[model samples]
Target: CLEPGTLPEPQLVASFLDLNAPVLARACLLLECAFFVNRCNRGEWPSWMKMNLPLPMQQAEHLTQASSQHIAISISGPAGANSDPID
Candidate 1:
């Protein structure tokens, strides 16, 4: 999967949400997160990071946790956080 290239950006994720398509938004966000985590695992940041297997292992687990939390929050809707904005 680490095919020596630039990271892919989730171009229309915001647009998906703007159009009231949360399922699409979540899918797009998940993809973005996946790509990001994969890149981190592959250490594809040019001269910034070297490949490390341990980092890859941790990143995989973190992605699962992060994806679930983000999806759960999105499914619950914006009414909860938008109303509070602080806590």
Candidate 2:
């Protein structure tokens, strides 16, 4: 029962990783990419990403939708910039 837009506590996040490492890892990677794009758009970079680590690089828009049952996250790359209707 995870809520959308709200980050879980560190302990919970760790437990989730332990419970579903592969799936959570992939989701985390996507989140990191989204954060990176957001930071780039803001014209500020921390040392880690700016140093050129082997991280996935892509310009994307992160969209979130909330319903009763679940939160839907939609990520669109540069090619699909206009695909998301909920600006």
Candidate 3:
């Protein structure tokens, strides 16, 4: 189990997500909500604001595109939110 406030390594996070998407999705939703609330209270917006969390549709697309034998992870905002997929 992950210790509090200690993020898993990037590769481990990807592996975990691939193994259990629904659990990761629920955890992500909660974490995103907490992060947003904290950021709002502090009045700080990072340069890549919307890219912080991929929306449900984006996640679905990524899952479909990646092979079952391999997991490719990318974080991007919704198409309508940004001109470039990475931005």
Candidate 4:
């Protein structure tokens, strides 16, 4: 998790932000790193998602509740940006 007062660099490379570049936001690291998902083509997702999780299905409901509080997030896009994300 990102602690207060420790933000990343101020400027970003224009090219890197060209398309709907992926943005890493609200990263929360669970103490127990027992779960992870792989990134693959859209075609492969259906089968991959069907795989059972390490934990029981009944407790999976808790996975989505990553945060108990919310904060304002403001992102200003470039003046003239065009392009779509690769993935």
In each prediction, how many residue pairs overlap at the backbone (N, C-alpha, C within less than 3 A)? Answer: 0, 0, 0, 0
1 Cα displacement, candidate 1 (Å) = 24
lDDT of 1 at 56: 72
What shift in Å separates residue 36 of candidate 2 from its native position after superposition?
0.8
What overall lDDT, based on C-alpha atoms, would model 4 receive against the true structure?
0.34
TM-score of 4: 0.15
Error at 18, model 4, angstroms: 3.3
> Which candidate, 2 or 4, has the higher TM-score?
2
Better of 1 and 3 by lDDT: 1
lDDT of 2 by residue, 1-87 (tens): 433233345576557655656886758745765675677678666664467644343222112223312422234344377665766
State each model's C-alpha RMSD to the native: 16.3, 19.1, 18.9, 22.1
Question: lDDT for every model?
Answer: 0.64, 0.52, 0.59, 0.34
| TM-score computed on alpha carbons, candidate 3 | 0.26
Residue 17 in candidate 4, Cα distance off native in Å: 5.2
Per-residue alpha-carbon lDDT of model 1 for 24-83, expressed as tens digits?
Answer: 657856676677678767756544334433477798999999999999988778667567
Which pairs, if any, clash in model 3?
Answer: none
> After superposition on all CA atoms, how large is the RMSD of candidate 2?
19.1
